[model samples]
Target: MSGTAGHGTVKGRDFRLFWFGETVSLLGNGIAVVALPFVAVLTLHAGTFVVGLLTSVAYLPWLLLGLPAGAWVDRLPRRPVMLVSDAVSFVAFVSVPIAACAHVLTIPHLLAAAFICGCASVFFTTAQRAYLPTLLSDAELLSGNARLQGSESTAEVIGPGLAGMLVQAFGAVAGLLANALSFLVSWISLRAIRVTEPPPSPPPEVRRRRLRTEVRDGLRFLFRDRILRTLAVFSAVSNIALTGMSSIEVAFLVRTVGAGEAVVGAVLTLCGLGGVLGVLVSHQVSRRYGSARAVVICLCGAAPFTLLFPLTGPGAGLAFFVVGGVGVGAGVVAANIITDTFRQRYCPPDLIGRVSASAAVISFGAIAVGGLLGGVLGELSGVRETMWMMTGMYTLATVALVCSPIRKLRDFPESDESLRAAEAEKAVP
Candidate 1:
């Protein structure tokens, strides 16, 4: 049992299959990161505000459906939820190329597609996060998560560059097609997993009252847990700043830095390399320094470099953004891996879906707010100024983590058993 547990993830056929599918899907998402905006700007002749609006619309589902999605995922089978999500995204994305081919594509149609895909993502992502603990034991989670983050970071590193070439060669519509195909591949890979999920614990027979009660319970638990609450707030604030930066980034490159599409893609790709570096280093950092301290150190260390972004310029000066991007990327991913692992281990198995969803509602919902803010700010203050404003906000957002209770701990809770034991002691009356 010890030997099997030690290298479980490495030898687990189901895990490898799941990881491969997610990796492919991540790469497709990377392509869309570049493709979707280009389609709005180039194909639809969208302005900076419209571009930001498009980005905001894509994340709007998190605000609208994030909490409910989490509750629903907890009540249903995770694999089927994921499969359904992929199918929805597949249809929504594939519709774009079909419309484009028939000459009926418009900005509204693209926005509708994005909104639909975003809704699918809320269910898929919440289920997937909850599902990971089922696949790997607590001891295997760090390594498993790191491997997943590494592949996702790699996708970020490669996706944009590929998107650029595809857009340049086959046009923007090709990226959506690529994304659709990727979803089909993900569906097939998930369908092939052989692990039988444990049956969900039965809920009370309250019918309509049960769903609302379960959803509220998730929200209540998240806010009641000090560590989870702090982490959730930190994520929400950081996402706002990050999404604001991203919302106007293409415009910043095109208008302020005088970059073409290919150059923009290449530069963003360079930024993504830092995430790969972060993922590779996270396990070692957590082991040596501990996860709690690692989060603070990573955030504090990465905060200052963001100031470098606003200084970026056309020609050789653009290297400033690359340097800043690398720092932000590495720090962000390291922080993410630590927090994600912590949540998986710390939350109760029954509540994780709701916890993930509730947390996501705050974090991802902030993204929507940030997107709109970025658009309004960009239109008023200009893109470079907005970058400076947004990046500066990110630097300040670390204060939440610095002051949080986690900083007092040596490390996050190690496992479900340890966490449950602590809870039992606290429950003594």
Candidate 2:
């Protein structure tokens, strides 16, 4: 792979199809990001705490089901897991429109709906972590993750803007219908992809012993791996801050900055574009300066900028959007590449899902706390002060990583054979 943004070399055929499926699915997810709160607050008339809870509901499944989901994903057929998960999300989202049409949509019902969809997302994500490695070799992971991050960033930029306009134009309930349709589309796309995974080696004759052993083994290994431990810590602390920022985004734009929903959507979308650019360029940047260097630069520089969001002028909104997006994109790419590359290299094939889920549970669980704290911070300090504090949160994320040996990782995957040999070695002893 020459450049990031998926241009260097197209990866595995199965990966290509799988990537397309995920991209579409992410777009649908983006639609929900906009549609959910608006539906709760603007449509069903939810209070501030309720809105935060709605968001938290979406993340709760990760924390509650993480270990089990990971174990389950490891044991299942990934492609089918993906397809069925999307299908489940499809129905959960569609129910909103059906409920609204029937004039029966209410707060509790919506919460239940969001929780169900979130459950589906957990399965999809755990399966994805295991599935992606199967699609691309260690050599292609950087470019592959770049593409994935790029698509997500692009969706961040584009999807919300689209959601805002659609919600405003058609109403949030109607916009959700579009989101449902997007998931349906994603399901169809995944249905078409064919992948080949080496069958899992048979477990020992004792079933519960083997399963529980594998689960504990993954957790033990992840904690013992200095690199992954750092990644997990970095993910938790940084996400806590960022989630706080996310919690206050609407209030910051609407109350603090006095920008309307469309403006907020546009501003957020600009951040998305910056993220897309970061993802596209990160691979080359990693190659030129090294992945570890890129992570440090992004983490140190941009993470603090979250604090500066409230400090702006006329025509300055674009700068804020682009800079913030770039910071998020770059930091994420560096971290993911480092983590995925290492995990794929180090993790036993059987334990990938549990490790991935455990990591996510920690990260998203922090996000849940961050989002709640952000809401409280916004109400108490006002959006501007709260965001200024957000800058510190980003800084905290960097500091967490600063202590890690991975920070000095100057090169990636010394050699393919060597990388596999390392995995093989781990398997043997």
**Top model by lDDT, which number?**
1
lDDT tens digits, residues 254-359, model 1? Answer: 7778999899889989989989989988877887998889988888888887888889988888898888888988998998898898888888888899989999
The models' CA-based lDDT, in order, is 0.87, 0.72
Q: Tens digit of lDDT per residue, candidate 2, span 1-429?
A: 121234445555667776787787778777778778778767887655566677777788888877778877777777788788889988998999899989999999888888888888888988877887677765676567767876787778787788788777888887678778888888887777665565545465423465666567668867876556777888888888877777666655655566666776777777676566666666766778775566666566666556556564335654674576556765665556545655666566667788888888888888777877776777677667777787787787687677677666665444335655766887995
Give the Cα error of residue 241 in candidate 1, in Å. 0.5
Span of 10 residues, lowest total lDDT, candidate 2: 1-10
How high is the lDDT of residue 46 in model 2?
68
In model 1, pairs of residues that clash are none
Off by over 4 Å in 2: 1-8, 11-13, 210-212, 312-322, 412-429
